[model samples]
Target chain A: MISFFNVSKVYPNGVKALQGVSLQIEKGEFVFIVGPSGAGKSTLIKLIFREELPTKGQIYINGRSILRMKRRDVPYLRRQIGMVFQDFRLLPDRTVYENVAFAMQVVGAKRSEIKKRVPEVLKMVGLEKRMDDYPLQLSGGEQQRTAIARALVNNPSTIIADEPTGNLDINTSWEIMECFQEINDKGTTIIIATHAKEIVDSMRQRVIGLERGKIVRDEHRGVYANATT
Target chain B: MSTGVYMQMLLLRQAYYIFQEVGRSLIRNSLLNFAAVGTTAISLFVLGVGVLLVINTNEIAKTIESDIEIMVYMRHNLAEEDALTLEPLIDNISGVQETTFISRDEALKSLVKQFGDEVEESVGEENPLPDTIKVKISDPREVNKIAAEIEDLPGVESVRYGGQDFVKKLFSLTNWVRIIGLLLITLLGFCGIFLIATTTRLTIFARRREINIMKYVGATDWFVRWPFLLEGIILGFFGALLAVGVLYFSYGALIAKIQETISFLPLVNSSAVLFRIFEGLLAIGIVMGAVGSTFSVRRYLRV
Candidate 1:
């Protein structure tokens, strides 16, 4: 579960990225954050991971006030929520298996656990056959799947994906969305921030729309209301 | 399994991973690792050479100082029997090791051997060289003190040891060499640290993307740091070991040559001192390497 209470963020250069944004996301909810460029969507996602603290108000994850969390505890907090970037940030030199295994390794998971879990997660992402291939050898969709597998390897309760389909073709994007839908069906809360209008309208999920640093809409089974692309 | 056994296994696995990561990164960035190792070895070698020079200089100074002898000249009219009586007085001085009485005739004979028979003929029947007691002291530092004491002895006219100004200059020279060597070692130590730090920084910068990915996946700061720290330490260890190897053989050859060419110069025997220097160099190398990596990786570890 995630909650934001009157959260606001202002950059040092005086740009307001988010303004008094308050919302609650329930457990196991698959949600879409629909917004255009410069709409504070990225900042919202960053706040969930404690990448950037709320400038004026409190944010909580699973009833814990992350704003007051100690610096040393931030990593442990991150372990509870997986993150995926638009760029598919996999280490190019590392194979898909190593990249996924690294997630478990970081948490000091036992070698036996890592050995058991990494392949299982790769299979879940449907990349089991390509697990030994380097990221450079994988297609864009496969690379993104590898990233997804890495995110899932830690068994995080929530996945915050910023523009998960930003770099993929429509067909590939849908495949990736199908993976997210499957992951959410298994009760992992999913919050995806994207500008893909067709996918949002087709998915028919809970949608929150933002424009100019403020949320203007929140709807159940929502469509992409503003179609400016 | 028992909890204690499980914990031990976990620690062992963690150590294995750390070492594996260190080796992987070293090979991945082989050029940079090589550069760091080379720089560390050269810096440690310079430091080792400075240490050897200071040690040898101190040894030479001690040898030279110990070789100094005080010549206690008998009164011009004093008989040989009476001059020999002054020997006991010279020998009784606190620092005196031994005393040898050189009769005036013997001194004249040695002078004539040096200046040929013309000097002997010039002196003719009158031998002007004084009957002197050559006094060796246990400590060269006490040479001036012993000389002063011997000067006051009965039937002794004057005592001449190494000139006071010359002795002072020699000590000051050795002290300066030691101070300068120490300063140079400190300076080169920092230079080595900086070089290793810079190389590590560059290596980390090249892998910044991998580090960023690690952070996103919840890698702790220390987890990310272990490999780099280990890499730095390895570089330092190998660098220092190589330098020690080179210094061992080269210093041995140099000492051998010095002994053969200038046999009288009291060089420090290699076996007695080189091993200690090797140990010191190794410690310095490893410490510098680890410190350099720690310092360089600090900025990047903030995730």
Candidate 2:
């Protein structure tokens, strides 16, 4: 579960990214944060990861105040939340299996555990056959799937994705959404900030609309927009 | 497997990864690494030479300190009794340890022994050398003070210490060398660190995406830091090693040449002094490397 109370973030350049926002994401919920450019979706996602500290508010993940945690404790908080990006940031030189296994390797997981879990996660994301290939050898969807597998390798409680489908086509975006749905079905909360109108409207998951650092509307099982709010 | 054994294997794997990362970055930025190492080596080399010169100077100073004496030459018209009376008065000075008087004949004989038969042949029977009193002082550093006091005495012609005025100048010059060497070392050390920091910063910038990925995947700051720190250490170690190795061989050759040509000059044992100096240089190199990499990486890690 993730909760934010009156969270506000102002960049050093005096850009207000988020302000007076309060929300809660229950366990296993699928959340899509939809907004136009510069609408604080990225900042909201970064806040969840604690990438940027909130200028004025409190945040709790699994009922623990993230604002109170020291710098040393931030990494542990991040461990509970997985992150994906629009660039499909996979190490180009590493093979698919190595890429996924690396996430576990860095956190010092056991070899047997990595060997067993990496293949399992890759299979779930349907990239098991491409394990030997490098990311450059794979298509856009496959690379993004590899990233998903990497994110899931650690079994984080919440997976936060910022524009995961921004670089893909309509079909590829659906495929990535289905992958997130499958993970969501398996009891991991998935939160995505995206500009995909069709995906949000057709899937009709919980949609929160933001405009100029403020949440305008939040609806369960809602489309991207309801006739311009 | 036993838990202890498993933990050991894990540690070994961790060590392997850190080294592999270090090796990878070193090879990846070989040009920059070479430049940093070469630059650091030259600075350390010059610093080492300065240190050796200072060490030799201090050794010469120590030898001179033990034998330091004020040579008091008497006026030629002074009687033997007046010169003898001057010695007792000179000995009354608080710092005077001993006063040995030498007659004109005795001075000529010792000069011939020093300059070979030519000294006696040049003098013939005239014995132009002046009678002298060698005044040994309790403190060699006080030679100037004691010499001035003796110079004022009526029978004494002049008082001389440190062989000639230039030898005293050499001591002061060496003190300047030491001071300048310290300042130069500090400046070079900063440059060495800055160079390493630049190389590592470039590496960090190049591998920035991987760092972002590492951070996202829950890798701790230390997990990212260890490789860069090890890289800095490796760079520093190799640079210092290059410098000290050259210094050792060059110093040995220089010492051998000095012994052959300038036999009068006394030198400290090179091995012990060089060992101590090399140890210090290598340590400085390592610290430069570590601090450089740490400084560069700290900026990016703040994210």
Candidate 3:
């Protein structure tokens, strides 16, 4: 679980990305943070990862104050949470298998451990047959699946993605969402920041809307647009 | 296995992985790597030549310095015996190695011996040359100081040890060579570092996405640093080897062909000295590479 207490972030060049916004995300919840471009959606997610600290306020994850975390503990902090990006960010030269195994290798897992975990995660993402295929050789959905597999390989407690389907078509976007839904069913906390209006409307999950760095709505089973507000 | 041993084993395996990564990167970006290595070799080679020049010039200066003898001329009005008595005073000076008294007639005799008896016939009865003492110094660097002390002595008119201007010129040529050589070498070192750093920065820039993925996946900054550091050292090693190889053989050949022409100038001929220089150049090249990599890779390894 993560909590932000009156967090406000003002960038160095006098840009206010987020201001006085506070929220709590419990364990095993699927939440979508929705907004147009430059609305602090990405900035809020970045604060969770501690990539950029909140300019003023405290953030806590799992009852520990992430705001007070020391610099050397950053890797251990990141290791507990998986991250996916819009770009997929896979090493173009590596195979699907190597790309996933790379995550385990970076955290110093033994070869035997990597060998066992990589295949299991790849199979879970439905990419077991394309283990040796390169990223350029895969479809958009398959590549996103590979990215998800890599994010999941390290067994993070929560998986946060930023615009994961931004580059995909409608069909491909739905498939990627289904992939997230399947992941969510496994009881992992899933937080996605997206601009996909139809997917948010149809999925009917918890939705938090932001406009100009302030959260205006938070509701369970919410629609993309509020019918009455 | 014990825990310590197991940890050591794991670290060894990790080091091997880093080395493999370095090899893969080097081959993956061969053209850019070749350019970095080429610049390192050329800069270090020029540096090696500068060092050798400094060493040889110092040796030449020392040989010439030791051979110089100061002539302390007696006053024209002084009796030859009175001037001869001043030889002990000249010899007593602290840096004065030895002094020999030469009467005017002996000076004339040597001159006559050189120019034949016609010089004695043209001079008639009187020898125009004054009685003088030839003074040798213990340390060439102390010549000016010793000459001043000898000039203040009674019965001494002037000291001529190669004109004052000639000695000043020689000192400038020898002493300034070292300071100038050091400055040039330092500048060349910066050039080599800049080349390596720029090249490594380009490669780091190209693979930034990979680095971002590594950071997101919980890879420590050191895990990313290991490969780049090794790649830099490898580039540096090959460059230094090339420079040392060229300098060693070329210096040996130069000595063989030119030693007789400048027989008195020590010429830095010994293999021991050359090997020492080669070792220094190799060490310098490797340090330059390591420093270059450290500077460029730090910005990309935030985590």
Candidate 4:
């Protein structure tokens, strides 16, 4: 479960990125955070991982306030939430298998667990064939899928995909979404931040839309509502 | 398997992977790594040799000073019984190791042998060298004090032990050698740190993409950190090994030849001193690598 109570972020440069935004998502739910560039979508996701602290209001991940968490404790919180970036964020030198295993390795998963889980997750993301291939060798879609596989290796409670398919073609982007759908069906909570209208319309999930650092819409089955509003 | 056992296996595997990554990175960036190592080895080699010289110089000086003896020249008209009685008194002095009475005749013969046949014949009838009591001090530094005490004794004409001027000059020389050695070591240490830091910084810079990926993927600070630290350790160890090898062989040859030519220098046994230096080099290299990597990575890990 994730909850943000009246959260606001004001960066030191006098930019108030997110203001008085409050929202909650139940466990095992898939949600979309839709916003334009500089609309505070990234800032909200960053808060979940303690990358940036909200200047106002408290953030609770499973009832634990992370706003006051110690610096060292940030890693433990991160271990429970897997994150994927728009760039795929895979180590260039590592093979697909290594990239996925790296997440488990950071959490100190056993060698047997890693060996067992890495291939399983890679197969789930349809990257089993490219397990030996490096990120540079993989296509944008394949790299993003690998990134998704890496995020799931630790079996995190929540998966946060920040523009996970930003660089993929329409079909490949849907395929990446289907992988998320399949992952979601398996009871892992999924939260995605994206600007893709087709993605929001097709997913028919609870959507939280932000405009200029304020939440403009929250719907059980939203449709990039701010653009239409 | 137990949770603890499983956790340990995972940590070890992660550490191994990190070490492997570090090794591959070092090899991939071999040119820079080699530069790091080469600079460190040269600096350590110079530092080790300088320290070795200072240590040995002090040792040899102490040995020489402690072995010195004072000669007390007797009055020409002194009675033999009184001279003989004074011998035991002089021998009983606190730092006096032994006292040998050299008769005027024997002293003349030694002088003759040293100055050659011409001088020997010239002083044959009249003994130019005085009948002296040669007092070997247990500690050479006490020679002047003992000489001063002997000068006031009955039946003693003069005390001919070397004075403070020679000791002052020797001490001054020793001090300068130590200062120079220390200065060189300090300078070399600074240069070594800078070289290793720059090499590590460049390596990390080149791999910034990978580091960024790791950070985004929920990798802990330690998870991202271990590989760089291990890389530094490997570089340091390799450099130290090369330096030790070069220094050991060079010191062995030079010390052997120098000891043979100038036996009085008391050059420390190279084989023995080499082991100590080797240990120090190992410590320095590892610490340098770890510290340098830690320093360079912390800046970019922020944010």
Candidate 5:
């Protein structure tokens, strides 16, 4: 579970990105953080990862206040939260298998555990047949799936997808969303930051809408509200 | 298996992977790796020659130190027993190589032979020169101690030895050679580090998307750091080995030719000394490789 209490962030240049925002995201929940181009959507995700600190207020992940967490403790926090980007971010030179294996190897996982986990996760993403293929050889959707497999290999409690389908076609975008939904159903919290109005409207999941760094509306079944609001 | 064996196996695997990665990357960027290896070889060769010169100069100084002599002049009334007893005691000193006792007649004859016609006719039947004991020291620095002890001996009139000015000069020369060698090697090492750092940075830059992805997937700093660090270390170790090996062979050949040309001269035996120097060079190469990679990787890992 993640919680934010009156969290505010002011950049070094004195631009306030978030203003006293408070929200609670429970375990096994699927939510979308939607906003216009500059409406603190990225800031909110960065806060959860502790990549950027709040200027004021407390932020908690699993009941631990991360605002005062040390630099050395950041990795452990990251291990609990998996992240995916719009760009597939698969290593061009590494095979799909090596890329997935790398994620586990970095955490000092045992060889036997890695051997078992990597293939299992690749199979989960339906990329078991393409394990030896490099990222360049795979299609855009397949590459994103490979990335998602890498994320799932660690079994993170929360999966943060920042514009995961921004570059995919409409059909492929839905396919990616389906993958996220399946993972969320399996008891992992999912927070996807996107501007895809159709995606948010189609899911009818919890939606937190942002405008000019302020939460204007939040609904359990929000519509594709216009940014003109 | 025991814990020790497990750890050993783990380390061996890590080492193997590190080298495999290095070899693969080197082949991928063969041109750049070659440039790095060439630069290291030239720098090491210059550093090696400087070290050789310093070693040979020190050997020369040792030879000069052993040949230095001091003379103790005895009084005209010195007794045979006292003089005989003094000879044994002086010979027992640590630095005393050997000693020759000369009587007045023998001293006069040596002076006549040295001065030639001038002393031959001027010195009549009676000898004018005092009998002195000439002492050779194994170490020149101990000359002063021997002279002081001899001066305090019974029937000793005066003790004379050459000034320490020559020995001090030799020491300064040898020290200068060492400083030059150290400075050249340090400068070469710095160059090697810069090259490795730049190479590693470029390699990282080329695969930046991969790094960005790793960051998204929640890779730790060290997790992100390992492959790049390993990459640099591999580059450094191989470059150093190549440079050191080439220098050993080429320098060995050169030294052999020089020895053959001047076998009559008491030049330092390059054959025996080269092995010791080759070992030292190998150690320097490893350090340079390791250190160069470390400096190169630290900056890129900042993110």
Candidate 6:
């Protein structure tokens, strides 16, 4: 569902984040994009969401060129894809339910639909009982779960998570990974960019490795190899 | 439901959400919003009072101008019949409203009233007061021209009126008052807008994370903008209402006392003037609120 052709990104300060990268991922595939810091993993993910434009090539999502899309159409594109971040960007003042319901409200979902779906999504993340609690009132893992619940409440076709477990303990990281596994099992495509070598090796999914702004390896049922070659 | 009905329902739902967001933010940043509203109220209040002052000053100027009268003194040795003939000539002047002939005897009577019975007895039967034609003009500003025309008329000695310099000074003073009042209102209006804009900018900056989250969730630009715009309008409107209430009671009491003690001073009718000022203040308040928020929130809504 995503294709990048000869994509290159160079910052104004002369740092080349990505250079001549090309890749394709089919729908309904849970893929891991593995790389070290400054290895173009985040830049690749940002390009998919049109957060930053490719400097030298076209990126397509579902047969449409995102590089050619009008500025106003970006929001509709975002609505079809959910995003999770390492920080669990929940409004501290709002309750868990509000945090999740906010996503649906942004898409103008009916009040009834939001009421029906928020609890179901929270249940999937295992936080249904704490829906009334604010983000600050929850543990780190629980807060991450609430963010995941918010991401899922939109019922998007794809989920792009940027280091979703970077701040969590190893145990909490496994739990968050399990939540992603459950979501993937239900047929939503998942793309994760991460540095967690153990989780990457254990998942045994399609892995694309990046090194020095270039994709060094693409393997099916891959292991997280340390060397660039 | 029909499509039109469905659309209306959607609009109503959206309005409810926007207003709910406005209420939430208002409470969230109550202190800042309170200061914004208070500044707006004071600005509008000062503007309203300045407008009323200008209106009343104009009214007073008009009253004074209307009371101006020209005195056409007849020649000292002119016959009584000849002096009476000058009445129609004075009345026919372009600016003259009307002219009344005051006989020597009537002039002597007014003189005696001013100088007492000793003067009356001293001039008994020898009435030395000149026969005069009292002239009222349509416009006080036209007094110099009409007085000059009457001075050249036959059987007239001199034309006398109140201080021309003083009349000119009154007109210039009122003009300056109006100009300065308008300038102050404009300056205060911009000050209020600036304060509101800064307050809104700070509030939006504080909630920028929430806004970023909203953008990531695919909220449309207008969806994000509506609540902030409504917040500004509500603050502005509430401030204006407070100012209007204060102006109505205080100005009414002050005008009442002024009228009681200084009965001759001309003041504009308070109720109608206050009502007009209230409407103007509300309009200015709402516009300032909307405009201030619109400009302040623009830079942060790049998403």
Worst 10 residues of 3 chain A by lDDT: A63-72
Model 1, B1-303: lDDT tens per residue? 999998787667767777888888888899888888899999999999999899889998888877888888888999999888788877777989999989999998889899899998898888888898888999777787888888877888888788778777888999999999999999999998998899889888998888887788787788788888888888899999989998888888998999899998888775757788899999998899899999988887675
Q: In order, what DockQ does each candidate have?
A: 0.57, 0.68, 0.60, 0.55, 0.39, 0.60
Model 3 clash pairs? none
Instruction: Tell me the TM-score of each prediction against the true structure.
Output: 0.87, 0.90, 0.90, 0.87, 0.78, 0.89
Put down candidate 2 lDDT per residue, A18-41, tens digits, no spaces: 989999999999999999999999
Candidate 2: the clashing residue pairs are none
Q: Taking chain A by itself, what TM-score does each prediction score?
A: 0.98, 0.98, 0.98, 0.97, 0.96, 0.97
What is candidate 4's lDDT per residue for B79-166, written digit by digit as tens?
5567778899998788889999888777777877788889876666766666789898886666788888988898899988767688
TM-score of 4: 0.87
Model 4 residue B172 distance off true place after TM-score fit, in angstroms: 1.9
lDDT against true structure, model 6: 0.89
Model 3 lDDT tens row, B224-263: 8888888888888888889888888888888877876865
Candidate 3 residue runs with Cα over 4 Å from true position: B1-6, B73-88, B100-132, B138-145, B151-158
Which runs of model 4 end up more than 4 angstroms from their true locations? A12-14, A110-112, A225-229, B67-69, B87-100, B115-128, B135-146, B300-303
Candidate of highest DockQ: 2
Residue-wise lDDT of candidate 6 within B1-303, one digit each (tens)?
998988787777677778888888999899988898898889888988888888899999989988899998998899889998888878888989989999988988888899899998888777888998899999888899999999998888999998899789988998999899889889989987887788788888988998899888888788888898988889889889888888888888889999999999999875666687789899999999899999888887785
Per-residue error at A55 for model 5, in Å? 4.0
Kindly list the interface RMSD, in angstroms, of each predicted candidate in the order they appear.
Answer: 1.6, 1.6, 1.5, 2.0, 3.3, 1.3
- TM-score of candidate 2 on Cα atoms, chains taken together: 0.90
For candidate 2, give the lDDT of residue A134.
98
Per prediction, fnat is 0.67, 0.60, 0.60, 0.60, 0.40, 0.56
**Between candidates 1 and 5, which one is better according to TM-score?**
1
lDDT of 4 by residue, A35-128 (tens): 8899999999999878889999999997789877877777778778888889887888789898888777767677788889999988898988
